[model samples]
Target chain A: MTLASPLAALGRPVLAALAALGRVAIYAGQTFGALFSKPFYTREFLSSLLHVGWLSLPVVGLTAIFTGGALALQIYAGGQRFSAEAVVPQIVAIGMVRELGPVLVGLMIAARVTSSIAAEIATMKVTEQIDALVTLSTNPLKYLTLPRVLAGTLTVPLLVAVGDIIGIMGGFLVATGQLGFNKATYIQNTLDFLEGADVVSSLVKGAVFGFIATLIGCYHGMASGRGAMGVGGATKTAVAAASVLILAANFLLTSVMFGS
Target chain B: MIELANVTKSFGSNHVLRGVNLIVPKGQSMVVIGGSGTGKSVLLKCVLGLVRPDQGLITLDGQDVAKAEREAFLARFGMLFQGGALFDSLKVWENVAFRLLRGPLKRPKAEARAIAIEKLRRVGLVPETADLFPAELSGGMQKRVGLARAIAAEPEIIFFDEPTTGLDPIMAGVINDLIREIVSEMGATAITITHDMTSVRAIADRVAMLHGGVIRWTGPVKEMDVTSDPYVQQFIHGRATGPIAAVR
Candidate 1:
């Protein structure tokens, strides 16, 4: 085999990936430009808010509550190794607000909202509804993508805020009812341990992660191939990409906010 | 009038269209006949500016289509997809009234609904059908809804892409007759792409046969039967052997 063959093989996928990224950037720019234009489609925007925000509450609440309970138990156990059991309330507050709250909400949205948006749009594309929109003098980006993206961007942070509160409440309930800690002391420790910066960073992460998830969903759906398999593949890729990007964005935002 | 001169398009190694030339005069129906994957749909999409030609001139009434204002350019045309491209999220009336409810054509909600119901009636659908989703309808009913939606804005030009596909013969004939009647009534310039000779005879004032990425033959529909062009003859007669292959 030629020495250049391996290098060429490696370069091919790298180039393809770069091209895909370029397409995604262009798509994002177009959606952003279309965001402020006239013909706002307010009905679609409200519907999207209901879909991406209101409907997502149940799953978000359940996930947050369970994670918080487990997290409190884990922190209690870990603190025992250092004879630092008293730190449970403080650590759970910081952990849920600064990390678990936003990340878990983001991932849940990736699984729930991202996959749903991708599948629905991809099916519309395969069935020519997008083309129909174009023929009707409607820009699909404005009619479809912008509303969902805006909903995700605006609502995910609120969802995360809710998650953080619920998560802290779950920890408080566990620490008081099960761990023999007084309720009032637990609440005070959690409140005093959480700073405005930590809460702000968590919400910021939520917004960024929301944008990534919905945008990825729309992009994949718009670029999907033809038929059922294409819709399936788009859903799979959107969820996977959104999840990874949310985690990566979380890390980057964390470093920026807390780095030395 | 709409005209395409020396149009060409390719996707990867597939040269779907090469140097196609044709014209459709205003107020006449033109049916383009070709087998599956012979680029009939691509050619229709080209005229709608949904697909750009690699090299060609497409003009609508002496203005270059490529340079026309997109909203205005698309405003003049309506299309019925092979599959009824109705928005599943919307009711039948909402799908029909989609163009009226937004953009420059915006109408009051009640007026749009009234127009939608009228258009639905024009296509022989019951007023009750207006409140239902497309999924609730049968295949034939969905096609009628698509037809109603296509003509909702009363566009100057209309396109039918395989309008008779995926229907029983009776339903197919019903759709063809409805299309013919609608085109005549609206006096809208119409272009249809299909392999069904029945549809061609029923709908076309003029006919063009596309094969091998080009227009092999075109003439008035009455002359199509007598045309000796091998490809046209083979296609019209549904022959097994001809200049066109049975397999790609």
Candidate 2:
């Protein structure tokens, strides 16, 4: 039955998007359930941790350092107009811990880990390795999705914490060298300005972004269509979805944690 | 024994399985042959509980497989996929012993590796091949590794999906002979889905022809040549024009 209504033109794609969202939510729920279930694949978990966490450090660290340095320079220029140059240390600390650190780490993960995970698992599905896992009496969700999700959720926070430190240090280096701030005074102000809640919020944002990135990767991989184009499309969609969701999640988390 | 009664499955506008009914008896090799997209693989998956049928019943040894305890039910079956589908991340031995190293079939690490090596040898691969990854092997070698993985647990029921697809004639012949010998030696019930007549002749104790989602014919292999059904006749003789309607 064809509808004469103009809304019909927009109906199918919107419905498909909603349906895809529904499937991802269900998949996420099942993965969470699998987390507590038996036959937990420790071997898969550790290997995934190594891949999604340890291997991702260099990219996240490099992104953070550069971003922090750039942020300090921009803030310094803007501060000059208002004669607020004395606020560099405090501003840099707050910026790194509260916003740039988690967001940058999350986006880096979306670029590095999400695409790789999606490509690897989508290839596995294409080759029937996933079906083979089923025949071998192994739950693919338990063996594949849960470990990657757990590793991402647990490790990205730590990555964010490390990134926060490195980013703040980058700002300090730039401020002390180019901006002529006193090293001792900058360090003291940075330490004095950062509260425990700031650290907590950064770690919490990291954890949430990590979950979003990894879960989207696994979801796209599992729900991929058939053949090479299917896998390629899935890999692309995973990164895009992870990036967008990381930003959206960051906004939601920020509002809840700091808006009040 | 496995049975599918009035099973039906469809994907949107496509009707893949339509009221299909068939029975595979114990301790015998049953091969189902059909053109591409005839739902042979879907039927196989339905029995394995990989794809749930939209309607009808599938039973293994008279018990519904869908309702059986998943781990115990799957432990009884092994399947060799169309492609080798070996885990590229792991060594060949690790792929072979994947089942043995985890879940209900868990074995000690050394024991699993040893058994994997033994199974590899049984499929004509040397112990040296065990350390290489699947990507390092030729297509034929990867298929042999898949065969090794299939039999690693010595499952009571084995399903081979297009076992000889994508192989040269010589390699296909070798795989067919190996399958016949191994299945006979293991005394396991086997179901192989393939359009390769050579494989059917070499492996099937019984033949079932599937077309339009139902069994068009079923009988002993000796009578496959004599089957009067037009679909069976066309498929066996490789005819483009028949009741099977290739383009439609």
Candidate 3:
């Protein structure tokens, strides 16, 4: 068989990507319009906060702690190569507070919460429950998407803050115990390196990531195709989209916050 | 009253509905019957504005349904889905009283639960089932719960989409009977879509046979057996070899 030209091989994938992007744009437009329309679901939003935020604390806390510990060790080893081991506590504290904590929490939520929301909503759409909601005079966007998005927006920053504190503590533990740094000095150094700007930047990143995660989940879920296979595909797509967007947004936010 | 005029819907190259027209007067039960993928459900969805018609006008009480104020228009309708789509996260009572518990019609939780339990009882469900999650209920029980929720808000128009698809014959009959009683008692206009002849006979005051993207025959239920339309005869008789191809 003769080999196809490079252009032909790339045509299908490019067209498919453009189609996907168009669909996403449509979903975003619908979601944004519905969010401001009548019959807002405040109770659903509060309940979703409890479900997505309060219930997610334990996992976020554990992940942050372990990540902080590992970062401290790695930073300590790397610093020694340049005779900069004295910078371990400060570097770990600044990194955890400004980047790792929020990014990690956002990725974790994309894996857990985004997948669950997408699967649940996609199943509802496939099974015609969303139609039922429409017949009952309830807007699915108001009833379903608003609550989850509101919950994500409000709760994610709090989770990130909690994660940041826990991570810094983890770094402190490693610095003081394993690396033979004086406990008080390590604590003081970490405190000195961490500024209000770092905390604010992390929270801002958390909010953006949270919005992207829930938006992707809701969009994919609402637009899912028919059957069990459709729901599964939507769940996978939602998580993947949310994770990638979170990382990209993290980089953009970091640049804006510190690159000047 | 609900009316669909020249409604057409298609998914890409597949045409699901082709200028279908139908009318159901106020408080009348209009059962739409057809084989699967014949656009029966799509017709009902078009009227409810769930699936927008490519070319058509849907009117409720002479107001264009497609352009009607959505929330007010929807408030007048209820629906029972094929799968009894109760929220798995909510208690049975909350699912039943979903509308009454929030929005402009918000009521006290206790009062909503009381109404939910009462509606559940009307459908032959026990009060104890109110606190249980949907997953804990049997298939028959879930259908009954769905019926309860459908009637909870006392909507003026109720749409039942395959309300008896998966239940046993006995249970299906029970649901059909319940649907008939509830629609009559509430004096609500009803539109039901089903392939089940039993549901057609039990719940429909007038039956409309949808085939080939349009209504093939429409008349009183008593006339269904005597219809000369080959499509109707083929469909109601479940004949594989007929004027209507079986491949669809």
> In order, how many clashes per candidate?
0, 0, 0
Off by over 4 Å in 2: A1-15
Arrange candidates, best lDDT first.
Answer: 1, 2, 3
**TM-score-sorted candidate list, best first:** 1, 2, 3
TM-score of chain A of each: 0.97, 0.96, 0.93
Candidate number with the higher DockQ (1 or 2)? 1
True lDDT of residue A36, candidate 2: 81
Question: What's model 2's overall lDDT?
Answer: 0.93
Candidate lDDT values, in order: 0.94, 0.93, 0.89
Q: Number of the top candidate by lDDT?
A: 1
Query: Which portions of model 1 show Cα errors greater than 4 Å?
Result: none
Best candidate, TM-score-wise?
1
* Cα-based lDDT at residue B191, candidate 1: 99
Off by over 4 Å in 3: A1-38
lDDT of 1 by residue, A206-258 (tens): 99988998999999998889999999999999999899889989999989999
